[model samples]
Target: MTKREIDEVSGVETTGHEWDGIKELNNPMPRWWLWTFYATIVWAAGYTIAYPAWPMISSATSGVLGFSSRGDLKAEMTAAETAKQDYAQTIAAKSADEILADDQLREFATAAGAAAFKVNCIQCHGSGAEGSAGFPNLNDDDWLWGGSADAIYHTIAHGIRFEGDPDTRYSEMPAFGDMLSKDEIRQVSSYVASLTGNSTDEQAAAAGKQVFADNCASCHGDDGTGDREFGAPNLADAIWLYGSSEAEIARQVRTPRHGMMPAWSARLGDTTVKELAVYVHSLGGGE
Candidate 1:
């Protein structure tokens, strides 16, 4: 038979339609490819039966094994808690001071305190305890409350400015607005500025001495040296809480400034609070 005739008579036919003088073959899919397509369908059917593959209006189909992603997380947490129990039990038996001495307990406390500080103290104390405008530096020697280990522990246990905790440290810088005249406040501010070697109007500072004697002497001492028990900051030292500017001082005298540090005892738990105290104490300037 001739080649053209043979092609025409072959059972594998050509598409009846042609485009641009070219005809397409009407070919069956490869046997292997067909088998693969069928296998995919069968696998999908099995998967749908075994797992949560279908979605409903308000819920998804529960798999036969009743597996859940949340269950995996809970299992992981349970294991971690089990591991932590030993350390927790050991810490519970020791005092904060003893924990500081023990290498393992100290390491654990440091880690725990750092985590809690990031969560709680960082907002006011800064990530590195650098402190902000009103907040005191945990890294510095100047402590409103004493810097001893016990002192820090006490402060953390009972937060300053916390309402309903009568034992919580409390101090109020009386506003000069009702008590001292604006001129007197300005003078006192100038005198406060002078304590830090910050430039002040000489006349204002002169007038401020009288104002200091009358209003600020009780808590700040006659020379602005400050009272530790009262938490009154020393104006003589360069450490300015609200800022050393004449305006800031004047504003403080006129409308006073009160800063409250949140107590961390309950939030950080006892061991962590102790660790934070130790960490702050270790900071170079800590008293």
Candidate 2:
């Protein structure tokens, strides 16, 4: 064994290790640091004995404490559900309108509805309830059916054009592609476009007035304002389920695109439906 060398400048003993003529000093670890290191080792050993730490072939070692994160999470979830029981029961007992009358209950319903909307409705209606191309935007005043709380509740409970639910709000716009000529379809589309904004073809709009009265007036109303009773969308409003373009109008006049919503009440339960209705009503446009 080689004898230890003393560092020249510091007068401290040098470690046997050296690199590029630079010798390492064999300084002792600080008392605090050494204690901390030993404490960590002790803690590790105690932790292994008290809580799960070692991994075996098929399973991990269950420690003496027998504590599980899963058990803790389950207990917390049960506590939360129990706390909501009163509010849930009260919501079930009250109609959406009745719940609105009670400030406390209404608040609870709105929060609950928001949670439900995030989980279920966000996929189609969007996270902000703004809606996609085919879906109806819930934030706006324009409604294909009606916007009242009761009406909204009815739609949520039964759904729109949902085949699964017999009482689903149903409306069918007869596809005029087979019945009407291309020119007639274009003419009517131009007229419909002229209702809300300036029509691209003024001459077509002028000529299409008679075509609209003859074919579309009964369902869309003579002025193209729409009839909610028939679930006809208002052509007068800029808010459109499909689009506002003349070409989009022509396409709708020819083929028509129908949208469907699932009956949420059957899936989420009546209380949740009421909460959703109350929450949706509070969004902005509900009557």
Candidate 3:
């Protein structure tokens, strides 16, 4: 057996573990630290007994306290829902315009609607409400139906061209391919593009002016500016719901794609629909 070594320099006992003439000191922990360590062990044992610590086959062992984080969360959620009941009821009773007129209610509805929009509308409108190829950008001033808070509410509540809702905003552009020759469609497309200074062919645009005046002037106006009552989009605007390219415009002229929006009132109810309208109107484009 190897005897433990003592360092002569400081009279401290060595652990007899030596390498390269370096000896380890055999020092006991301080009394306070030892007591603290013992206390922690006792505390840990108590904690395991009082809290959920054991694993089982299908579930975990319930502690003596019978406390669960999920249960607590459920209780908290119920409390939060209860607290919002009054606001929800108030929103249900009031009109969208009335809700927007009130600053406090508007603020609340906007916040709530923003949350709802993230969950429901984000998939189609994008996270920032910047629309894609076919979707209408909500941040811009261009509106097919209208941009007013009331108008937006009506559109969102009832939807656009939604067959399920009898009151949905409905409009259908005639497929010019069936009515006009291919050259005429091209000429009209160029003219429509020329309304926004996007046309390349001046002669074609000139020829299309008469065609537009004859067929499209009633709904789209003489100057190519849209009539909102008919949900006709302005041909003069830079914002294009589908695309602005000459080919794209020609395609739309040949065969128009009518987009459909589901009536949210049937699914989300009137209060939430109003809230959504208020929120959408506040996106900096509302009239």
Candidate 4:
């Protein structure tokens, strides 16, 4: 056994271990630091015993205090739902128009509706309600059906071209590809495009005017303004569900693509549907 050596310069004990020419000092840690380290170990042990810490194969050990984050969250959610019960009940009983007429109910419905829209309608209507191709933009004034609160509620409750619902808003534009000659389809396309100041062919548009007046004027007004009762789209508007280009217009003239919106009332219920109508009606374009 080798005896520990003392440093000649400081007269302190050496660890008796050396690397090269350097010797290590046998310096003990400060009493405060050592005590703190021991205290932390004790605290960690206490914490483990008092709270959930150990994991098992199927579950974790429930500590003595019986605290659970999931339980806390469930309690909070229950409290929130309980508080909203009255408001939800009132909404269920009231019509969308009646709800909109009340300022407080309208405010609540709009906020709730906005939340629902993100979950249900955002895929087609977009996050900001700006529609994509084949979908109608909700923020714009142009509505194929109608834009009023009642109208919007009815449409949302029943849906557009939804075959499942007997009361669904339904309209069918005859596919002109089967009905008209190719040249006649092109002429009518030029006329329709001309309504929106998008046509280039003057003679074709001229000939197409008669074609439109004869075939399209019955559903779409003589001036190309839409008929809300028939759910016909206004041809003169800048907003187009498909596209406004000549090729797109020609394609629609040949074979119109009718978009379908699901009847949300059947799936989401009346209260949520009313809220959705209120939210959509508040989107600046609602009449």
**Candidate achieving higher TM-score, 1 or 4:** 4
User: For each candidate, what is the lDDT?
Assistant: 0.78, 0.90, 0.90, 0.91
Error of 2 at 241 (Å): 2.2
Please provide TM-scores, in order, for all candidate models, with all chains considered together: 0.66, 0.75, 0.82, 0.77
TM-score of candidate 1 relative to the true fold: 0.66
Model 2: per-residue Cα lDDT over 202-271, one tens digit each: 9999889999999999998999999999998788988988889998888888998898888987899999
- lDDT tens digits, residue span 240-274, model 4: 98999889988998888998999988999988998
For model 4, what is the error of residue 76's alpha carbon versus the real structure, in angstroms, after optimal superposition? 1.2
> In model 4, which regions exceed 4 Å deviation?
1-12, 45-68, 97-119, 122-129, 176-184, 282-284
- Output the worst ten-in-a-row residue range by lDDT, candidate 1: 1-10
Q: In candidate 2, how many Å is residue 190 off?
A: 2.4
lDDT of 4: 0.91
Better model by lDDT: candidate 1 vs candidate 3: 3
Error of 3 at 271 (Å): 2.1
Candidate 3 has a TM-score of: 0.82
